[model samples]
Target: MLTATLCALLLVNLWTILRFREDKRRAVAGARRIPEADLLALALIGGTPGAFFARHRFRHKTRKQPFSTWLWLIAAIQAGALIGFGWPR
Candidate 1:
C-alpha cells in the first residue's frame, strides 16, 4: 500500500511539474501569475519533486518570502520522510 501510494505521489509530482512548466511558459507569454497555489497543493500532497522542479524550472520563488521558504522546508521534510520510511524491511 505504501509503495503504491508512493508511486502515485511520484506520478502526481511529475504531472504537477509538467503543468508548472506550461504555466511558466504562458507567463513568459504574458499570462497572469502562475497558479502557485496548485503547486502548493501538490507539494502538500507529497509532491516535492514538483516543488523542486518549479523552483528551478520556473524560477518561481526562491526568494526570502514565507511561501517559498515554507514550501522548500516542507519539501525537505517530505524527502527525509521518504528516505527514512522507504528502506527495505
Candidate 2:
C-alpha cells in the first residue's frame, strides 16, 4: 500500500511539473494558459514539492501575487499535518 501510494505521488508530481512547464511555455508564447486554480489544486494535493521544484527550475510564478502566498500556505499546512499525524509506518 505504501509503495502504491508513493508511486501515485510520484506520478502526480511529474504531472504537476509538466503542467507548470506547459504554463510557462504558454506564457512565453502568449497563448492560452493553465488556470492558477488548477495549479493550486495540484499543490493542495501532494504536488507541493513538485510545484516548488518547477517554480524554481522554470522561474515561473516566483513573484506572482496571492499565488505565491497561497503556495506557501499550502506547503505550511502540509508540513503541519505531517508533523501532527506522524509518518506512515
Candidate 3:
C-alpha cells in the first residue's frame, strides 16, 4: 500500500509539473498572466512542489507583489500542515 501510494503521488507530481508548464506557456502568450487564487488552489490540491519549481523554472510568480507573496504563504501553510499533521497515527 505504501508503494502504491508513493507511485500515485509520483504520478500526481508529474501531472502537476506538466500542468504548470502549460499554464506558464499560456500566461506568457496571453500577456495577462494567471491569477494567484488559481495557483493557490492547485498548490493546496497537492501541487505545491510543482508550483515552487514552476516559479523558479519559468521565472514566474516571483514578483514581490501580493500574488507571489500569497502563493508562497500558501505553500508555507501547506508545508506546515504536512509536517505537523501528516505523520502516521
lDDT of all the models against the reference? Answer: 0.77, 0.96, 0.73
- Give the true-structure RMSD of model 1: 2.8
**Which sections of candidate 1 miss by over 4 Å?**
76-89
Better of 2 and 3 by lDDT: 2
Estimate, for each residue in 1-89, the C-alpha lDDT of model 2 and write its tens digit.
Answer: 98999998999899999999999999999999999999999999999999999999999999998999999999999999988898643
Instruction: Point out the worst 10-residue segment of candidate 2 by lDDT.
Output: 80-89
Query: Considering TM-score, where higher is better, how would the candidates rank from best to worst?
Result: 2, 1, 3
Quote each prediction's TM-score.
0.69, 0.96, 0.69
Tens-digit lDDT track of model 1 for 1-89: 98998899889888878877777778788977656677678888877777687768778666737778778788788768868998555
Model 3: lDDT to the true structure: 0.73
**lDDT tens readout by residue for model 3, 1-89:** 98998787676666666766777788778866555576677777777787778778877667848867777787788778868996554
What lDDT does model 2 reach?
Answer: 0.96
Worst 10 residues of 3 by lDDT: 31-40
Q: State residue 70's C-alpha deviation in candidate 1, in Å.
A: 2.2
Sort all candidates by lDDT, best to worst.
Answer: 2, 1, 3
